[model samples]
Each structure stands twice: as structure tokens, then as C-alpha cells.
Target: MFRYFLNRLGQGVIVLLVLFTITFFLVHALPAGPFQTEKAIPEHIKERMEAYYGLDKPLGVQYVKRLGTLGTADLGASLRLEGRDVSEIISQAFPVSLQLGLVAMGLAICIGIPLGVVAAWKKNTILDYSAMALAMIGICIPAFVIGPVLADRFGQQWQALPAMGWSPLSPSYWLLPAFTLGLVSAAYLSRLTRAGMLETLNQDFVRTARAKGVPEGQILVRHCLRGGLIPAVAYIGPAFAGIISGSLVIESVFAIPGLGTHFVKAIEFGDEPVLTGIGLLFGILIILANIGTDILGAWLNPRLRSSR
Candidate 1:
């Protein structure tokens, strides 16, 4: 297990390195600098600004300097937000995103798993069809669309919740945004879980369990659920990363202040450092999530444990 973990960690490091390199170059390759816009600036002021940010240095030198900072766990100051460091910005913004993501993930697991299990257990029935139909609607509709409609229905018409903005002290602030982010993922998970459960149910071990007169509930929970959940477990890593990063449209619609909002502004303003910092953070989250998924997968599947 130790060796397996180390191997996965090493792979994750390599993936992050590749992602960082690509993002660094791509951001640099953009046509204009962070200061350049429709208005013209004096040449000397531009030169000084470039020198101040070390943008006057060659791209190779800048890359190496940034790499060194990364090695030392220093994200440096934000070019766009004067006097603010990237890490500090991330620290302030990420918690809101993290809270939202966790809530969404919980919603997905709680609702999706039961719906899927019931659908699979009662296949070819009205319950199965109704659950699948709802899942399909979730899959088809984007969060941007769902968010406003929910806001209007619940927030405007019914006055059940606020239409926009988030409040850390209040749980009510979490519901609308969390639900919008989770709905699509819940649909995907339900389908994936149903498929996995159906496949597990058909396996020879399941038949043997039934033949041996194991209680159906025990067989389903003890024998089948672990295997049936493998796919959903695997999917959680990347999906969770995506959720925690904050959806651009959802954030915009809800007026939530998260890393994603900064990310979008950074792009528009050509704030390469902010963009790169956020991108690196995203890569790290994804890599860590996948590593966790691998560990969980091994624990759930004896074949994986032995193979590793």
C-alpha cells in the first residue's frame, strides 16, 4: 500500500508539472501584456511597469523564476490586485468554493445513490422510468439555466431563498448555488451507479449469494454495494475538483465571490500571474483528488490491492 501510494503521488507530480508548463506558456503567448489595453500609455511608463513586474525579462528567465517560486511554495503578488499575494487571494476565496463544492457533492451522493439503487433493484418499473427521466432532464439542462429558474421560482416568487450572493453565517445562502452545481453531477452519478449496480447484481457471486439464501438486503448492501460503487468512486475525484474550482456561469449567475470569478477577470485583463496561480491550484486539487480516489478504489477492490 505504501509503495502504491508513492507511485500514485509521483504520477500526480508529473501531471501537475505538465499542466503548469502548458499553462505558463499559453498565458505568455497571449497577444498583450496585463497593462496593455485600448488606451495608449507612455513608452517609459510601460517600460517601468514591465521592469517592476519583471516582465522585462526574457520569457525563459521569467519561467525559471516562477518555477523557483513554485518550488518554495510562494505564489507571489497579484499583478492585478496591488499589495495582494496570490496565495492570500486563494486562501480568502477558496473556502467559499470548497464549502459550496462539499455541499454539492453531499447532495449528489445522498440523492443519486439511493435513486440509482432503487432503479436498478426495481428495473423495468415505473419507479425506474421516473427516476431515469428526472436524471435525463438534469443531464440535459445546464447550470446557468437551472440556476436562474430556481432563483426566480424559489427566491422571487416563493421568497424561499435569496436570489444571489452568499452569506457565510447562514446555511440558506448555500442551498441554491449548491443545488445548481450538483444537479447535473447527480444525474451522471445516478446513471453510472445504476449501471454498476445492475452489472454487479448479474455477477456469479450474486447468484451464489442468492442460492445460499442470503437475505436480499444483506446481499445487496454487504456483497454488492461495494463493487457497485466503484465507478461512482472513480468519478468523484475529477468531479469534486471541478466543483471546488467553482463554475464560472454559476458564480456569475449567483454573484458569488470565488476563485472562478478571479480566474475569469484575470483572463480578460491578461493577468498571467493570477491565471497561472489559479490554474496551478486547480491542477493540484485534481491531482490530489485522483490520488485519493486511487486509494479508495484499492480499499474497495481486492483485485486492485493484489494487482498493485
Candidate 2:
């Protein structure tokens, strides 16, 4: 188990390096200069601005310099935002994205796992059909549409919750955004979990447990569940990649100040530092999520646990 974890961790590091390298070059390759706008600035002004931000340096020198800063965990200065560092902006914004993602995934897990269990337990029944129907609806609907509809029903018409804006003190602010993100994730999880649980429940171990006179609940939760939930757990890593991408739309709709919002703005302005920083930050998160998923899968499967 320990050896497997170390292997995963090593692979994660390699993935991060590749991600960072790609982000660096891609951002630099944009056609629009970071300091340029619709109206052209004076040549001298542009040169001074470029030099000020060290854009005057050769690409190799700039990459090496940025790489050095990255080694020290500095994300360099934001070319689009005056007197701001990408690291500073992200430090302020990421907590909001993190909170939103966690709540969204929590909702997915809570709703998806049980719904899947019951659906698998009573396969092909009305309950199974209904649950899958809802899951399909969720998967079909885009978050952009859902956010507005939810805001209207709950915030505008019903007056039960705030429509937009965010505050750590208010759980109400998180609901629409979190739900918008979670609903799609829940749909995927339900499908995956149901499939995994259905397979595990029919396996030899489950049959042996039943033959041993194990209580149905005990067999379902203790023996089969660990194996069943592995897919759901593995899904979390990719699910978060979706969740964060979804948050891009959700953040704009709900006026949430998060890394997603910055991410969108960075692209619009071609803010290299901000774009690279947020990209790598997201890359790190997804990498870590995947590593965690691998570790969890190993824990649930003895065959994996015994392997390096």
C-alpha cells in the first residue's frame, strides 16, 4: 500500500511538471500582447511597459526566470492588473472556489451514493427507473441554464434565498452555485456507482456472504460497499475537473469571487501570469484529487493493496 502511494505521488509530480510546462508556453504563444488593447498604445509606452514587466527579456530568459520564481512558489506579477502578483490574486480567490467545489462534491456524494445503492439493491424497479430518469435529466441540463432557472425560482419568485453574491457567513449564498455544479456531478456518480455496485453485488464474495447468513444490510454496507464505492471515489478526481470547469459559468452567474472568475478574466485580458498561475493551480488540484482517488481505490481493493 505504501509503495503504491509513493508511486502515485511520484507520477503526480511528473504530471504537475508537464502541466506547468505546457501552461507556460501556451500562454506566451497568444497572438495578443498582454499590454495591448483595441486602441494601440504608443510604441515607447509599450516598450516601457514590456520592459517593466520583464517581457523585454528573451523567451528563454523569461522562462528560466519564471521557472525560478515558480521554484520559490511565486507566480510572478500580473501584467493585466497593476501592482498585483498572480500568487496574491489566487491566494485571495482560491478559497472561494475550494469552498464551492467541496460543497458541490459533498452534495454529489451524499445524494449519489445512497441513490445508487438503493437503485442497485432494487434493480429494474420503479425507484431505479425514477432515479435514473432524474440522473439523466441532470446530465442533460447545462449548468448555465440551471443557474438562472434556480435563481429565478428560489431567489426571484419564491424569495427563499439570495440570488447572487457571496459571504462565508451565509450558507444561502453557496446553495445555488453548489447545486448547479453538483447536480451534473451527481448524475455521473449515480450512473458510475450503480454500475459498480451492481457488479460487486453479483460477485462470488457477495454470494458467499449471503450463504454465510450475513445480514443483507451488513453485506451491502460492509463487504460490497467498499468495492462498490471505488468507482465513485475514482470518479471524484475527474468529477472535480468538471466541477471546477463548471464553476467558471456558475461563478459568473452568481457573482462569486473565486479562482474561476479570475480564470475567465485572465483569458479575456491575456494575462499570462494570472492565466498560468490559475491553470497550474487547477492542475495541481486535479492531480492531487486523482492521487487521492488512487490511494482510496487501493485501500478498498486488496489486490491493489498488495501490489506496488
lDDT of 2 at 227: 87
lDDT for model 1, please.
0.87
Least well predicted 10-residue stretch by lDDT in candidate 2: 299-308
What's the lDDT for all of these models? Answer: 0.87, 0.87
List, residue by residue over 1-308, the lDDT tens digit for candidate 1.
Answer: 78978988898789878888898899888888788878998999989988998999999999999989988989888888889999999899888888888898889888888888888988999999999999999999988899999999998999999888989888898899999999988888898889999999999999999999999899889988999999988988888888776466687788889887888888887887788888888888998998888889888887997887
Distance (Å) between predicted and true CA of 280, model 2? 0.9
Q: Stretches of candidate 1 above 4 Å error?
A: 38-40
Inter-residue clash pairs, candidate 1:
none
Clashing residue pairs for model 2? none
Model 2, position 171, has a per-residue lDDT of 93
RMSD of 2: 1.9
Best prediction by TM-score: 1
Q: Residue 180 in model 1: shift from native, Å? A: 0.9
lDDT of 1 at 151: 92
